[model samples]
Target: MTIGVIGGSGIYEALPLENVSTKSVSTPYGEPSEDVTLGELGGKEVAFLPRHGEDHQHTPTGAGYRANIYALKSVGVDRVISTNAVGSLREELPPRTLVVPDQIYDRTKHRTPTFFGEGMVVHMSFAQPYCPEMVGHLAESAREATDADVSEDGTYVCIEGPQYSTKAESEFYREQGWDIVGMTTIPEAKLAREAELSYATVAGVTDYDVWKDDSEVSLEEVLENAEANQESINAVIEHAIRTMPEDFESEAWSALEGTINTPTDAIPSETRERVDLLAGSYLD
Candidate 1:
């Protein structure tokens, strides 16, 4: 039961893993953000990938969403815990608050949000994007591990960006009742479902965004809050991994059971080979 952790801003390093070894994994999609770091934490095998590369070179749109998810899946990761630095749309959810979002709204315009396309197609049920069980575990872990406010559930509105949101855009998201605004999570969450891996995120609020009259989102401010929140995020992740039950079962494991649309024989050989890791069993 190897758990995969995708680190967001200010979280390039993972929790102290034992007997750590780094592995560079190439996928059919392309290269992963960085080498997958493998180690043991709380007696569980863990694989960690930095979402934006170790040096934060990749932008949200440029990060290899398909490759990263594929790489983790290839390395025997059955569950993924993603950490994100996000801006709060609500006043009450202030900086340093940790949110376990159960819902996601894709405001992203430029990203491939699926692993199945071209010669193969899968209509996976995404009514509930995040794995409820995983979300519960993360939320409980945060409450037990941190004194910072933990939000059990909320909507994460994912936008396309290297740029922060405009004042109008920020206000619109707030009007939509979204809790947090972030750049990543759209395609990552969508692709995880396609790969049959349980996935959820611990979003650490870094700023109030541009919605607040007196608040102006800045890199310095976001980084400061993210650094401060890293301690709590690390604690929650370590505790969750340590206490996770080995026999845990997720509906995501069978997500491809009846979702593959193309008949096995009809799929192009090249396309079939490309998706073999994700949909091969279903195609058979």
Candidate 2:
């Protein structure tokens, strides 16, 4: 099975993939953040996509979440591993800690979060946003492959941002018990479930958010820590891909089984064509 990777902040270049080639995939939603980089990593076929454009041109809210997920799914990717740079909401989970989040809280208000809204209605089970099995594998990989603190499960509060949180907002999230905060992950995770692709993220804490009295988030600080965390993140990703079971199965693969509400016959032809790659089997 081909593994897909969505590289977030500070991860602009393609992974160290052998026999690398690039494919420009056009999705029904739009263009992906960039062309998909295809190659082999640790004896596994891998497709790496930068969540932002190659030069980091796209903002969090501007990144084409739907197109990115659909493009990966189009390329025969069954599972996706995402990397993110986040701010710590808790003191103990300071900078450089790698968190494998099992839950997500969406604080995004503007982005399109689904591919089923226009002509079809599908209510995906999102109680557990990230794939549990994938989360386990990622946590295990981080533990074995890097010396960074590996947090098994945490709630990642994803806010809509090209901006960091204000002190008040940060404190509120802390009160709600969210562990780490980041800009991406909401529509990405949501769309992955809709696409029936197993998905999980290894989030690296880049800074202590403004919740801490003297601490404040800054681009320089975030970039520095993200750079520091890159080696560890890369190690964990490689290990996970190298050691993953060939026949690993996930509940996410059948996520759409009973989720579609719009009858197949009622779905518009254009909309059906748009979602064909994702729900054609069920609709047929």
lDDT of 1 by residue, 60-173 (tens): 999998999999999999999999999999989999999999999999988988887788877889988999999999999999999999998999999998899999999999
Error of 1 at 256 (Å): 0.9
Residue 119 accuracy (lDDT) in model 1:
83
Please write out the lDDT profile of model 2 over residues 1-284, one tens digit for every residue. Answer: 99999995344242567898999999889899989988898789998899988888999999999999999999999999999999999888999999998999999999999998787899879998999999999999999999999898989999998889999999999999999999999899999999999999999999998988888789999999998999899888888998988878899999999999998899999999999999999988
TM-score per prediction, in order, is 0.97, 0.97
Clashes in model 1: which pairs?
none
lDDT (C-alpha, whole model) for all candidates: 0.91, 0.91
Model 1 compared with the native: what TM-score?
A: 0.97
RMSD of 1: 1.2
Error of 1 at 241 (Å): 0.6
